[model samples]
Each structure stands twice: as structure tokens, then as C-alpha cells.
Target: MATQYDRIEPPLARFIARQNIFFTATATGDSRINLSPRSTDALRVLDDNRVCYLDLTGSGSETSAHLLADGRMTIMLCSFQGPPMILRLYGRARSLFHGTPEYAERLAASYDGEAPLGARQIVELTADLVQTSCGYAVPLFSHEGERDVLTRWAMGKGAEGLVAYRAEKNAVSLDGLPTGMPA
Candidate 1:
């Protein structure tokens, strides 16, 4: 069975805080739907109806591009250890790219003025519907730890290299949609 809520309650917020991973889904009417697994301590619940995450440089900027084309997005999380629940937040979102004041403010307020190397943008979502379903079928797996490969890779690339990499790889989605990354 599934339950729905208008906002993230206290318990739900706490549940979100404990999770080590989450997934994002987005797309435009004509574009391929994009789904990606995300980790790192990148997510923040701003309020009962709002959330934000630090967007790092990656091979594809599909989420950003899809949000630019259309604001619809869904964020989902499943418990892999204890509880058997799946949480989904359906909402509209926007990507605030680097060098923008909105991104700066959000980073300072939610991320404590610290963003990981190769940080690309801040994706803020205003969730209108929150749903939870039984995740009994979701296999349980122990969380060993987060990987350091992305941080190491970013360090090796350096700031300039990160910029160039984004221009080359993160500036557009696989479907040729612009991600709004600065040129």
C-alpha cells in the first residue's frame, strides 16, 4: 500500500536525513526521461515543501537540461537497510548554475558555504506531493561507505579542467538539449 502527504513531515524529514543515496528523474515532453543515482551528503530539506541538492559535474547534465526545458521532477529514495519504505517527491525544480547569486545564497545557507570540487549547480525542488509505498521487495544491503573517486577525479582535473570538461560533456544532454551551463 501507498500513502500520500502534502508536505514532508518530521518523521519523513528524519527518514530522508538518514539515507545515503537518492535518485532523480526528469524530462521534457519530447526528450528521453532521465534518471540518475545520486550520493554524497548533497541533499538538504529546506522546509516542509522544499528541498535542494548540490549538483556536481558529471558525464551528463540531463537533469539540468530537462529542468530548463520543463520543470517537472521526481526525487525518490528507498531504504536498503532497516525500514521497507520507498519515498517519492513529485515537484517542479530549477537549476541554479555556478556564478549565480541564487546558487551562492543557497550554498551558503544550506551547504555551509562549502561545495565539493567540480560542483556545478544547485537544484532546488518545490515538492507538491509526497508519497510513500511499501518497499518490501527492495533488497537489503549494508552501506559500506561513500566512494572518494569523484572527489579524487575532480582534484586531479583542477578547476580549469573541470570547466573545460563541463563545456565539453555537461553542457548538453545526450539528446542535444542545452543544460544552461555557462560557456
Candidate 2:
């Protein structure tokens, strides 16, 4: 069975804090839905109805493009090594790209300025509905640790190289939608 909440309560917040990874889903009316797994210690629950995460540079900008076209987004967190549980936040979101004032505000207020070299943007989600479902069917796997390949890659690329890479790879989604980049 599933239960819905008007806002994220204490228990739900704790569950979110314990998770090592989460997934984001977004889409526009005509674009292909985008779902990506995010790994980082960059998530923050601003309040009962608000949450934000630092989005690192990646192969696709589908989430940013889709959110720009349509504000709808869903964030999912599941327990892989704990008791069976899945939490989701459904609401509207907007992406604050690097060099934007909004992104700076979120970074200052939420993060500790320890973002990685590939940090791209901050995605803020305002929740209207929170849902929790029994994740009995979710496979239980032990978390060994996180990989540092992305960090090493970013270090090798350097800032200028990362900028060029973003220009070439993260500027647009696979659907040909502009990711509001190269600004």
C-alpha cells in the first residue's frame, strides 16, 4: 500500500537523508521523459515543502531542457540496504544554471561550496505531493562505496576543458531541445 502526505514529515526527511543516491524524472509534453540516477552528497531539504540538489555535468541535459519546457518533476529515493521503503516527491522544478544568481543563492544557502569540478547547476523542486510506498520488491544490495572516476575525469579536463565539454555535450538534450547553456 502507498500513503500520501501533504508535506515531508520528520520520518520522511530522515529517510531521505540516509539515502546515498536518488533518481530524477522529468519531461515535457512532446519530449521523451528523462530519468537519471544522481549520486552525490549534494541534496538539501530546505523546508517541509522544498528540496534542492546540485546537478553535475553529465552526458545529457534532458532534465534541464524538460524542466525549462515543462516544470513538472519527480524525485525518487529507495532503500536498498535498509527496510523496504520508497519515497517520492512530485512537483514543479526549475534548473538554475551556473553563473545565475538563483544558483548562487541556492549554493550559498544549501551547499558548503564543496561542489565538484563538474558541477553544472542546482535543481530546485517545490513539492506539492509526497508519497511513500512499500518497496518490498526492490532488490536489496549493499552499498560498497562511491566511484571517483567522474572527479578524476573532471580534474584531467580542467576548467576550460570542462567548459568546452559542456558546450559540446550538455548544451542540448537528445531530443534537440536547448538546455539554456553557453550563456
Candidate 3:
């Protein structure tokens, strides 16, 4: 069975926060699909209809490239520790690049006083529909700890180095799509 809403409700927000991992799905009009497992204290609920997350440096920038091409995204969260449930946020998203005015403004408003180290982009999600389904068959897994390797690597690079890393490693998707990463 399935249920849908115009936006995320209070209960859904609570459940999302409890999730240790979430999956992001994206695709262009024609290309390879991308489904990525994301973790960390990166996601934030801006409101019932809006969400945001920090995009860190990675080998492939499929999500950013796909979003830039198609603007559609689906984020899924499933309950692993409690009753069986799966929540999906279907929406359009825009990737804010690092060192841009929009990125700076989002950082100011979203990050408060402290800055996020090696922050590359802030993906702003505007959900058009929220859905929930029975997740009776989803497997359960325990979270160990947040992966610190990315953060440590980014920190070791410093700001300019991180930018160079993005140019070298994150500017293109595996499928050769341009991610529009900062220069």
C-alpha cells in the first residue's frame, strides 16, 4: 500500500531525522541512473516543503550532473530499527556551487556562525510530493559511526586544494556529464 502528501509532515520529519542513512536517486532524460547512499549530519529540513543537504567532494558527481540536466530527484528513507515504513520525497533540486553568492548566502542562513569545512555545494530540495509505503521487507542494519575519511582528506587539502580536487575529480560524472562544479 502507499500514501502521498503534498509535503513532508511532522511525523515524516521525525522519522527522517532518525534515519542513519538515506538514498538519493536521479537520472537525466537519457543516461545511466544514479542512486547514492548518503550519510553524515548533512541533511536539514528547511520546512514541510523544502529540504537541503551539503554535497561533499566525491569521485563521481552524478547527482549534481543529473539534477542540472533534469532537475528531478527522489530521496528515500526507510526504517530499519522500528516498524516497517519507507518515505520518499519527490521533488526538483538545484545544486548551489561553492564560492558562489548563492552558496555563500545559503551557508550563512543554514550553517549559522560556524562554517562547513570543504563544503562544495548545498542541494536545495523543493518537494512536490511525499510518499510512504510499507517497508516490511527492507533489511535492518546498524550504523557504526560517521565516516571521517572524507572530512579529514578535505581538510588536508585546504580550500584551494579542495577546489582543485573538485576540478580534477568531481567536475564530471562517470557517464561524462558535466557537473558544473566551480572553476
Q: Which candidate number has the best TM-score?
A: 1
- What TM-score would every model get versus the actual structure? 0.98, 0.96, 0.94
lDDT of 3 by residue, 41-132 (tens): 78889899998888888777899899888999999989888888999999999999887898888878887724557778989999999999
* Lowest lDDT block of 10, candidate 3: 110-119
For model 2, residues 1-183, the per-residue Cα lDDT tens digits are 999999999999999999999999999889998999887387889999999999888777899888888899999999998799999999999898887888888888888655778889999999999999999999998888888888898899998998999999988888899888654
Against the hidden true structure, what lDDT does model 2 obtain?
Answer: 0.89
Over 4 Å off in model 1, which ranges? none
Alpha carbon lDDT of each predicted model: 0.93, 0.89, 0.87
Model 2: runs farther than 4 Å from truth? none
